[model samples]
Target chain A: MKKQQSRPNILVVNDDGITAPGIKNLIEVVQEIGNVVVVAPDGPQSGMGHAITIGKPLRFDRVDLYPGVEMYKCSGTPVDCVKLAVNKIFKGKKPDLCVSGVNHGLNNSINVIYSGTMSAAVEGAIEGIPSIGFSLDDFSQEADFGHCKKFIKAISLQVLEHGLPPATLLNVNFPKGDNLKGIKICRQANAKWAEEFDERKDPYERPYYWLTGVFQNNDKGEDTDVWALENDFVSVVPVQFDLTAHHAIPVLNTWTFDV
Target chain B: MKKQQSRPNILVVNDDGITAPGIKNLIEVVQEIGNVVVVAPDGPQSGMGHAITIGKPLRFDRVDLYPGVEMYKCSGTPVDCVKLAVNKIFKGKKPDLCVSGVNHGLNNSINVIYSGTMSAAVEGAIEGIPSIGFSLDDFSQEADFGHCKKFIKAISLQVLEHGLPPATLLNVNFPKGDNLKGIKICRQANAKWAEEFDERKDPYERPYYWLTGVFQNNDKGEDTDVWALENDFVSVVPVQFDLTAHHAIPVLNTWTFDV
Candidate 1:
């Protein structure tokens, strides 16, 4: 038998399937720090949101995608893949950490909700694991990942050294290819896409609509992730899954409802 | 002409179908409040999360389900329904208020992430409209909705009169049956479902698994939605869409990282 691999078990996952160059680069970086096990979708699941497949059966198959990384392509959402990785694939062996993405586009601000990449990281955090979701502002197949390796390694090492709080994960976004810059920890910018549906004609000459939009950032706060990324820095925001708006509860209680 | 049906423009939606008894009851109650416009899923989309279809073409058809309620079943997520309703159906005129679900079960605690019912309401809030997502703790088709009518009316009217703050909506979860003691404006409980998959054999002896889980509450605070619902009180949590952990930013900024 071959020598058993020994190192910290790092579960690697992404939304852009097992074949994306972004994930390939991510796996290569993760391999330096630990034994990487990739469990990703078989195809692109961009803008899938925090969806989980419940109506259908999920399947996982081992695939030889990354050269030395042990990888599996699963027929499920990003959240489902994390579940399968933790529950079935690594049943008895708990992973030291789970890292998702290095996604093609940004998951800053409200895009985090619609991001399958962040969902995987959030799922890992929910399972009480230290997790991080990384994204580049560039949305291209050939987007440069050279600048991200150092930062990724640094953050991963930090996460390993200092454990994350429960039910929380890091949402890390990098500026597209340019001269090197530093890193900044910031809050998720309060922003959204002002959607404008493009109405087009189909082959049958019927009107069809495509969901498209332009990102609009109304928040001008200097401490926001959007601002930080714009200022030539990698923005890291500690995202939590528990969306409790704790401050609003007291205000709501004062509302009179005498019925 | 049937007097042109001067009705009060109410938007009705749910995680369940347009034909579900929950929405039907909700529509009936709202019909007393406004002219109802029903836009919901074609089938049950429970635990669908906040998924919106970006890669597929959406199809919608008009159907006559509830008398005097103009209904349309859309092949899109709950958030998509709200979008389509705002863009296509009510292109020019805004509805009085968007109400989503007298849903089959509770969307308390961390269940809000996987809640399609709340997604619809969130979509409305994003569009600068007042919205509410109401759910009963009972997950049965025969769950009694008689007790919900009065409370629903009161809350909806209050929202109509005193408009909801921008980017915020109410997440109201009622206790099962008619013995609701009162209403409580509470925060979301620190709770999550511990997932357990049951592996079994299919007809051809093929292995398959079903997702199952138990709700685990780590918090016992009386000021929580879970606690209020458990004690026969309706829980109303004012929900906001901004996912930024603003408080953690300063703390994260203190961490040392190189360029």
Candidate 2:
């Protein structure tokens, strides 16, 4: 009798829906390393952050998209997709690893807080699984993802071999260029989007606003993700879901709160 | 000639919708200290992390709910409420302080990542405003909030007097009790929701799932938000929008990624 070996099960998720080229490219790369199980949003969920659908009922449908891989399209946020996979699909059995995105746009610096792609990976980390979120610095639907496969595979393999630290996941951003520099492990830059709303009138002449913003980098730190991305390097930021400002705790403790 | 002293402008937001008792209580307290401008979701936006409305058009209607306060009900997430208030409602003039919720439920520990209430404050912090998010441990719509006003006012006044550290906001979770202990400035407890899906059949005979979870606190640290909340103390956690796990960067740098 021949001994059978089981492949590692990998849960792949993205914010750019199930049919997006970014996730398709991600699936193609990760499929080589494990048994891929994709549970992603049914539609574009960009800027959705870590939202989970509570007020509305969630529906998921199995689709035959990839050969030899199980795929489910979820009518919920990226975080909800992870929950559905862990609880309903996998029946509480944690996967070997979770990978989110090859996101349509960058989730670097301040964008990490507003990224549905990174949020999926963060959700995976919260569920006690090593996770990585990949993104390219391109927003176009026709953006090329050819250069991202090697980096994605390298990072995925690394996370699989050595699990990420507790409560932490990687936010990997690929610079959009032909001659790509190597990966750089860096911290999130102190950067923000200067919001500018485009005010316009609806058919009823009521004013409506469209959210738009310009990325502004105020930090001059060379070891930051923004700096690495600008230098054509794949910036790998070890992102944590713990929002605690540990340093500020001591300062706040000093203040008397006698109302 | 007497110099006219202008009251500090405060932006109030919540995830429990504009008409929810939580925001109404929040507006009532903050109005005592500043010029209150309430821009909150029109409907419940619970579990809506740092989500923003990008794909869909956002509409906000000026509502006259609170006396001597400007209130707007926005058709977007809590984070969207912050953006709309900053860019459109206030017309780019940053408010002196941004406060979100007397949230119906606790946003302690890992809950902060999935909280629309905390996300609103995080958004405000990203936009360089001194911000704070308040939540009660109770989840009932008719939960008593009389015990939270003093702590809320104290924290709000503190943030207004001495601005928070750059890029940092406060996640304040109040214990649901009549005799509440003093505030404890603490870190986010290492905790997570152990997801349990309640599978059921819809009207069409297809299976649909409702997301339910158990709060699991594996961290035994006393200086944590969870510990503080459980001890009948108001947990004041200084939260930051920067997702970077700074401690893990050096460890990741040791790993070779020469693929």
**CAPRI tier for the interface of model 2:** high
TM-score of 2: 0.97
Those runs of model 2 whose alpha carbons end farther than 4 Å from true positions after fitting are A1-6, B1-5
| Candidate achieving the largest lDDT | 2
TM-score of each: 0.93, 0.97
- Which stretches of model 1 miss by more than 4 angstroms? A1-6, A201-207, B1-8, B202-206
**Which residue pairs does candidate 1 place in steric collision?**
B8-B35
Model 2 per-residue lDDT at A36: 92
DockQ value of candidate 2: 0.81
Candidate 1 share of real interface contacts = 0.51
**Chain A TM-score per candidate?**
0.95, 0.97
lDDT of 2 by residue, B142-173 (tens): 99999999999999988887888878999999
lDDT of 1 by residue, B1-259 (tens): 5566455578999988777889988888888878789999988877777777788777777899766669998887898888888878888477879999999989998888878898888878777778899998888898899899899988887787677766788999988778889889888888877776678777898666567778999998998899999899999998887776666666666666644
lDDT of 1 by residue, A147-234 (tens): 9999999999888877776667899999986664788888878887766567777899866667777898999999888998989888
